[model samples]
Target: MEEISKHTIHEQDIVEMILSIGKKFERIVLRGAYEDILALFKKLKKKEQSPQHYYQEQYDQYQPSAPPIPPDSAELFDYYCSFEVHDCYEQVDFEGKGLVDNVYVPLLEKVCNIHPSLLECQRKRTYKYSGWAFNALGRVSHFLETTKLEEMNVDACECLQMLWDEVQVFGFELSWLAPQVEFALNMEKFMREVEKLEEEKKTIFMRIQELRMKFKEELYFLYI
Candidate 1:
C-alpha cells in the first residue's frame, strides 16, 4: 500500500494508528519515538480545553487523546531485568561485605512474600552482587561523566529513575541504592540534549565541509 500511495495518503492513517496503539507499546520503544510520544502528551496536557468549552454541543464532547502510561514509563519494564545476576557472578568474585546475604537477600525474600495487591511490588531490584551488573550500571555512567554521551544507554538511566521512584514511596529510607539513583536521574536530561546536539553537529559539519570544498572536494571523517 505504501508503494501504491507513495506513503502520502496513508500518512494521517499511520499517525492515527501510532496515536491509538496503547496496547502495542513496543512500537515506540526507542528513545527517539519515546520522546516524541512524550512531547505530544505534554502538548495535550498544556492545552487542555476549559470545562465550559468542552461539552458545548448536543451529546458531543471534545477529548484529547492520551498514551497508556506517562512519558517516563518507557523503562519501567526494565529490559535488563531478565539477565541473571547469579549467572554474572558465577565466574568472578564479588563480595557484598555480608550485605548481600544478611541484607539484600532477606529483603528480597520478604518482598516476594508480600500480597501482590500491595504496591504491585515485583521484587526485581538488582543489588549488584554480581560484577557485571555493577559494571553495567557504571558503563552508562562512565559515558555520561565523560564527553561520550552518545555511548550511554538511555534505557539504563531511565530504569534507574523508575527504580528511584519506587524506592521513594517504599516507606523507608533504603540508602543502599540512593546515590546511584541520584547520579542516574541527575544526568537524564542529557539523553535528549546530546541526541539533538549530534544532529546539529552533523548539519554544521556538512555545511562546513561544503564550504571548505571549492564546490568540488570530497573528504570523509566522523560526522558526529
Candidate 2:
C-alpha cells in the first residue's frame, strides 16, 4: 500500500513536468509562427513598394490622384511568391485558407515538421484528461457508495498510472522538439529587433530630410 502511494506521487510529479513543458513548447511554436507570418508581410510590403517608385515618377508628370486600396490575401500571396528567398514555399497553396492553415501551420512545419501532431496534442490533451478525470471520479464515487475501499484505491491507482504514461509519451516528444522550438523563438526575437532598427533608421532619415527642406526654405526666404 505504501509503495503504491509512493508510485502515485512520482507519477504526479512527472505529469506536472510534462504539462509545463508542453505548454511552453506550444506557446513558443505559436508565437514564432506568428512572427514568421509577420516577416512575410514585411517582405510583401517591400515588394509592393517597388512598383510605387515608378508610380511616383508617373504621378509627378501626370498628377494622377488615385488612392491605394490595401492588398487582400490573394494579392499578399502573389507578392509572397515573387520573393526569391521564398521560392521554395511558393508552391504552397493558400486559396480560401485561414491564417493558421496558410501561414502559421506552414511556417511551423517548415521549422520542425512535427507541428501538426504537437498542435493536436496541445489542443486535445486538456479535454481528453478532463474526461478521464471525470470518469475516474464517478467510479470512485460509486465505489464509496458501495463501501468498496479496496476497489476504489485500485481504480484511482489505475487512473494515475494512465495519466503518468501519457505524460511520459508527451515528454519524450517534447524532448526532441525542444531544440527546434528554441530556434524558432530566437529567430522571432531577431526578426523583431531587426524590424525595430529599420523603423528607427527610417525615422532618422525622414528627420534629416525634413531638416534639409527647412534649411532650403530659410535660405530662399533670406534671399528674398
Candidate 3:
C-alpha cells in the first residue's frame, strides 16, 4: 500500500512537471517533445488511470453518457463503376476502384493531418494525453500500408483491422482542441453507414442475379 501511494505521488508529480514545462513554453514548440510524448504515451496510458485520471474522472462524471447520432445517408461511400458493385469487388483488376479515390485517401489524409501540438497551447489546446496524435498517425499509416488493396474495406472494418479500434484512445483528443476527436466522431458515422451499405449491396446483387435468371428463362420459353 505504501509503495502504491509512493508510485501514485511520483506519477502525479511527473504529470504536473510536464504540464508546467509545457505551459512555460506555451508559445514555443518544445524540441523533441513531440516524439518523446508519442513514445511515452503507451506506458503513460498504462498508468493506473492515465496521467489525466482526475480530469477524466471529472469529465466522465459530468459529460453525457452518449451523443445522439444524427440520421444520415451513405452517399459518401459511393462507387461509380459502370460494372455492378458485386462484380467490381469480385474482379481481380478492380483495384478498389472507388474506395481508393473516396474513402482510403481521404481517411489517410485526415489521420495524417493530426499532430501532437506539444507546448504550443495558444488558445484552445488541451494537454490531456498531449501527444496521442502520433499513435493515431502510426496506426493509420500501418493499416493503410499493410491492408491489401483488393481486400481493403472502404469503411475500414476488416476483422482485426478496424480503423476505429486501431486508433481509439489517444487517436481521439480528449481536450477542447480535439482535432482527432472530430475525426473519431466522423468514424462512428462511417461505421454505421458501413452496416447499412453491406446489407444493401448484398440485396442488390441478389436481386440482380434473380432478374438475370428470369430474363433468360423468359427468352428461352419465347424462342423455343
Model 2: lDDT to the true structure:
0.33
Q: What stretches of model 1 exceed 4 Å from their correct place?
A: 1-154, 174-180, 186-188, 213-224
- Pick the winner on TM-score between candidates 1 and 3: 1
lDDT of 1 by residue, 1-224 (tens): 22523544232233344446545444333324434544554554544443223322421221111001111322433354321112111122223311222212322333323422212321243333232232332222222233222333555456445444543443432343344344345444545654555565565445434333411111121111
Residue lDDT tens for model 2, 94-193: 2111122122223333323333343344444454442232222222222222322223233333433332333344322334433322332233344455
Model 2, total clashes: 0
Model 2 / residue 75 / CA error / Å: 34
**Backbone clashes per model, in order?**
0, 0, 0
Write one digit per residue (lDDT tens) for candidate 3, span 79-170: 32121121112111111211121223333344324432321321243322322333233334444334433343334433223334433443
lDDT, residue 68, model 3: 9
Global lDDT of model 3: 0.33
Name the runs in model 2 displaced over 4 angstroms.
1-176, 211-224
Worst 10 residues of 2 by lDDT: 62-71
lDDT of 1: 0.34
